[model samples]
Target: MRSTNFCLSTEGADVILATSSDEKYPPENIIDGQSETFWTTTGMFPQEFVICFHKCVIISKLTIQCYLVQTLRIEKSMSKDPVDFEHCIEKDLEYKEGELQTEEFSFPEFQATHLRFIILSAFDTFVSVHRVIAEGIAQDI
Candidate 1:
């Protein structure tokens, strides 16, 4: 199957909730397909953002681009609403100076309607998530 960027906001994915947001930075930027635009955390650690797909999809991999992020956790839910989520992946990222941190995670084929990405901690007090790309195939329910 062809891999597609399911996280694109124009593709019907949405950022339902975010713990912190600056006036110029919003969670929606995470799925906007541009690395220059990013969502910044305005407060403490343990920030989060939830993305809801238009429909169920079988996700194979995920790519995240961010700055100053240290620990990241991802959860998934198949329910229509963003609830009953199960743990998917968690990782501690390396810091890259003068550049964005790019990480790729591969997963067993699984279907989900919503994906929640949590920033448990960061290398800096403030963190910014540039983009999150989900490679998946849409499944007909």
Candidate 2:
């Protein structure tokens, strides 16, 4: 068994994980004039389990309404080389003016030690979140 890492963020808002700088995830294959080196997390977990994140690094009480597209990935690993998982950050949350919408997602089972959350778009400057949860179970293969 391995571990997993988690990353979550809000749109238009910079975020700092563990003890890093505020960085935003860029759009897929789109680079207008934003920073390329977005911040992400290292291996934070090492087993099948659930991790919850209710607070987005940025602390503000603003909400918006928009569509969300979240993506979770597992890096390739070779038996000869040290097992290292690379979960790319994705733009998930979406918002328009000042409304709230829910986007629920589940990932296929994988042995990872890192997780990253990316906020695609939002209306305002802050991200409004009530509760965030992560659950992991053994894969039946």
Against the hidden reference, what TM-scores do the models get?
0.97, 0.32
Tens-place lDDT digits, model 1, residues 26-140: 8889989999999999979899999999699999999999999999999999999999999998999999788899999998888999999999999888999999999989997
RMSD of each: 0.8, 14.1
Residue-wise lDDT of candidate 2 within 1-141, one digit each (tens)? 432122223222112222222235222201111222222222222111111223222111212122222222212221222234354323345444434354444444433333333343334333323223233332233
Lowest summed-lDDT stretch of 10 residues in model 1? Answer: 1-10
Task: Report model 1's TM-score to 2 decimal places.
Answer: 0.97
Please count the clashing residue pairs in each candidate, in the order shown: 0, 18
Query: In terms of TM-score, how similar is model 2 to the real structure?
Result: 0.32
Clashes of 2: 18
